[model samples]
Target: MAAWQAALKWAGEHWSPAPHLHFVPAQQEDLPMVEALAREIWPQVYRELISADQIQYMLGLMYNVPHLEEEVRTRGVRYQLIREEDGSMVGFLGWELEAGSGANHSTALLHKLYVKPNQHSRGVGASALAHVIAEATIAGASTLQLRVNRQNRKAIRAYLRAGFEFEEDRCTDIGGGFVMDDHVMVKRL
Candidate 1:
């Protein structure tokens, strides 16, 4: 059974802005569509850092279509799509809800946010981020947290403009000696 089915409270479905962009909760069928986008977004970076297996592993954890389906199905997390009226997904955002333990009330984690590189600098990212903050606020989140690669200064600036402040530095313990530099940031809602 789907998480929404298992739950007693039903969250609302779907939102639209200006007809050009629609914000909707993810469904199982949308995963492949999102994954295709991720494929375009993922390799632009990871292929330089490690083996193809690790690249695949990273994508699986971050963008596996079925994993996204299961996340929505189990309510561990949920994905949203920002689609054009013509039915193409222009951007995507997904997050972890209620993910932290103890005293972390109303907390959310942004897992992924991507818009095509061609869509850069034209408010595609801003639009998607605005939608994300709105959604998170609706979910009663007091704060939103996300990690970005320290190398991604441009994105860091975007996060800052979106009201996030640098929280700390982090390291992803991939295993053994491998670690990825991550800058943790959070925005209070």
Candidate 2:
């Protein structure tokens, strides 16, 4: 591994083992693990912010194995599994390049970023975001964007602390009597 990667690995190993971020490439075989994480984390994160029915609907729409497979294989979404030194998965992120582009600034969408509830307030999300920023920069994307529920103050603050600015409000109907009311946030890399 490169020096930085080695250092990152060492940090994950020697620091608080459960919270430091070490990103492992998620493969098709890891789909079930990701689904399991969604099951565990989503309710904790969104329970008060959204209805239970909406939570279940969104989870099924997003984290099912076949959909995840299609995203990784055909839609070019990159899934990075967050792992501890002990090889336990703790979190995951998914991202993909957005459609529009310009010579000066390309955009990438941060489709998802979820850390275990117990792991919050640690540097896991920040570390994963730093890694994503570097990857986006390398891929020629100068801006990274994501959508968060408007009422999810914790997450909005986290994104703000990471230098993401509020871009706009977005409301999208996801069907099944659910609508996502969100704030679009963007960080210019």
Clashes of each: 0, 0
- Candidate 2 lDDT over 1-189, as tens digits, reads 357445544553454322445888788898888889999999999999999999999999989999999998876889989998778788999999876678688899999999998988778887887788879999999899999999998887667666688899999999999999999999888
Off by over 4 Å in 1: 1-19, 45-54, 100-104, 175-178
Q: Per-residue lDDT for 55-171 in model 1, tens only?
A: 666776657777777777776677777777788777788887665534546788887888777767767677677777887888778888999888777687677766677899998
Error of 1 at 100 (Å): 5.7
How accurate locally is residue 91 in candidate 2, as Cα lDDT from 0 to 100? Answer: 94
Best by lDDT: 2
Task: List the global CA lDDT of all models.
Answer: 0.72, 0.85
Model 1: clashing residue pairs?
A: none
lDDT of 2 at 87: 83
Assess every candidate by TM-score: 0.77, 0.87
